[model samples]
Target: MRIDKYLWCIRYYKTRSIATKACKEGKIRVNGDSVKPSRDVYPTDKITVRKNQVNYELIVLDTPKSRLGAKLVDIYRKDVTPQETLQKLDLLKYSKEYYRKRGMGRPTKKDRRDIDDWFDTPESPENKDDSEE
Candidate 1:
């Protein structure tokens, strides 16, 4: 199976287009070397993917023609290392931080005022009087 197809079938990506995009962007590698979307993949081949802020490493155990159920997904691929899982957790932490800092709803008039106030803070060195010392 092609690497992109295999990745799609295994549910590594939401769609084949996404898998292909990742491959084209060099986010997908085989055996430590970047591979094209058309690259053929076989059982036991190692694949690495970087999506968003997290990385994933998976070993192909079987090539399925279609997406499998959650229980059967394990039959196709295995998580070879903990790096990606750790990175994903870290990414989630960062995402939460971002949402907390930026707020989640559509920007209201008050929100815009707050944002402008933050940017206009006189504490910024560029706006400070250096000669005051």
Candidate 2:
């Protein structure tokens, strides 16, 4: 099976096109070397997919004729991703959740209007003196 097709079959990517795109971008590696989307994938081939800031290591166990069910996915490939990498992914998720305060993200519509009103209004007494010079 083609590398892209294999990835899609295993549900690694939502679509074959996405897998193909990833391969073209050099995000898919076979046996440690980046492979093209058309690269042939056979049993025992080692695959490394870089996605969502993680490097997923998989060993091909068999090539399925078609896409496999979520429960059956393990029959086709074996995931050997490191424990540390998965732990880091968990840490990354937690860090992102608290990266910003609840109300400190992008300004809301009303906040934007308030900012525009502030800037569009006449200069304040403190600002007026600086412009005169």
Candidate 3:
């Protein structure tokens, strides 16, 4: 299967466009070198991806005939070395914690006040010299 298609089928990306973009940006590597979207992928290949802040590494076990659900994900690939997997998990955990602590809710009055305070603070002044002279 093509690298991009395999990635899409495995649910690494939400859409093929995103997968192609990742390939173009060198976010995907195969056999320790960056690859294009059209590159061929086969079982036992080592694929690495840098999505968000985490680095995920997987070894292809089998090519899925179709897109799979979460329950079927294990049949398609296997997690790589323990240390790398732990690092990836840590990064994901940190990202989730950061988002949760920041509160993914609509801005409250207090939140707006905090934003305004930062903008109005003298030490972190906004550039007010917009007038072209």
Each candidate's TM vs. the true structure?
Answer: 0.68, 0.78, 0.66
Model 1 TM-score, all chains together: 0.68
- Candidate 2 worst ten-residue window by lDDT: 94-103
**Location of the lowest summed lDDT over 10 successive residues in candidate 3:** 124-133
Give the RMSD in angstroms, all C-alphas superposed, for model 2.
Answer: 8.8
Best model per lDDT: 2
The CA lDDT at 127 in model 3 is 52
Full-model lDDT, candidate 1: 0.86
All candidates' lDDT scores? 0.86, 0.95, 0.86
The parts of candidate 2 lying over 4 Å away from their true place are 104-133
Per-prediction CA RMSD (Å): 12.2, 8.8, 10.5
lDDT string, candidate 3, 1-133, tens digits: 8898888999999888899999999999999999999999999999998886667889999999878897888899997755976677778888777764665777778889998998886632245554333
Clashes of each: 0, 0, 0
lDDT of 2 by residue, 17-122 (tens): 9999999999999999999999999999999999989999999999999998999999999999999999989999988879765579898788899889988977
Off by over 4 Å in 1: 83-88, 91-95, 98-133
Task: Compare the candidates by TM-score and give the number of the best one.
Answer: 2
